[model samples]
Target: MNRIEQLLPEEIEKRSFEIISEELDHMGVILPEDEAMITKRVIHTSADFEYTKTLTFSKDAVAIAKELIVNGADIVTDTNMAFSGINKKALSRFGGEVHCYMADETVAKLAKERGCTRATVSMEMASEIEKPVIFAIGNAPTALIQLYNMMQTKQWKPAFVIGVPVGFVNVEAAKELIMETELPYIVNRGRKGGSNIAAAICNALIYELTRNHQ
Candidate 1:
């Protein structure tokens, strides 16, 4: 087998990260520790280097996210794709758990009753978790909207929000709403994201924490 073919997926990913970082440097992108973590993962997800320029973050995004993970916080994803993409073992080392309630019957019923998207209602349900919560939204703008509304109400706030839903619907508007809030967030500006992007971002944070702690 060829060298590339012989390499395991994790090895290929590691080597790819090295290449991606080198390319970002050539393009004059000097990212901070946390920003690099998110940017690289997003690029890893979409293979779109443009994300290096498009992804935005709150001042304390990574720090706050790491803190939440270290505290065994629960991660809530907007879709099962994101939920399945996270590094559960790494998160579990810090007592964190990943959750996705999009398929729940109650969420469906609530969304229908409230005239809102199921993703939005799911966030309301996720907000009830007693421990710190991290929201990884990758499939629905409505979820981001709901979270932003909660941020306004002071009724619920997550340790961090990764809003990278991919679509042409209310995706852009929902992300814009999130930016207006004071919550720590890592958002892909524009409508180029999805559950994979969201999951990659979450894994990036978890991986970084695992690396830094080691």
Candidate 2:
């Protein structure tokens, strides 16, 4: 019989946290509640404990993100997958909504014409919105690059940025670029990230606000 089969589902999860926590304790891991929550969830998703180190939170990123989310900041995603994964119903409680421009024809055309990625064009589009946006980029390095450049050039900033694009190429470089900036961000330090990480962190923040406060 499997070891997990011998336990209840809740027990299994409880044991898992206990194990992860014990492991972190051995490593002397200490973090604020909000950062720890997001890190734990990421570890839960990937089953990789390295996330405890790989996860980087700009000073007070979760707190800032919560304030933006609670104030109804618009969230712009790099992919529809990230867009779909966000807890929109919960976000809407604060008058916030999610957006993805990858499917927009105008963005596509501009991307093709400018020899840039569709995500790059989409970010340019996001800049036009009147409300401050929270950028959640997960799958494209170009998206992070464009957004970072735009912020520097235009001095326009998002309410917060989540940079966790996975894979090689410019992924690590893009994340590094974001780190150099003073923009508030939560970034997966290496190439180990994706749309799910981005969505999960956003949801974690939402859950933190609605559940932790209540």
Estimate the TM-score of every prediction: 0.92, 0.90
Q: Which segments of candidate 1 are over 4 A away from where they belong?
A: 1-10
Local error of candidate 1 at residue 141 (angstroms): 0.7
Residues 26-60, model 1: lDDT tens digits:
98889887588788878877889988777888888
Estimate the lDDT of model 2. Answer: 0.88
Scanning candidate 1 in windows of ten residues, the lowest lDDT window is: 1-10
Looking at model 1, residue 4 earns an lDDT score of 44
Mind giving the per-residue lDDT tens digits that candidate 2 earns over 104-147? Answer: 99999999998989999898889888897999999999999988
Candidate 2 regions off by >4 Å? 1-19
Shift in Å, residue 205, candidate 2: 0.4
In terms of TM-score, the best-performing candidate is 1
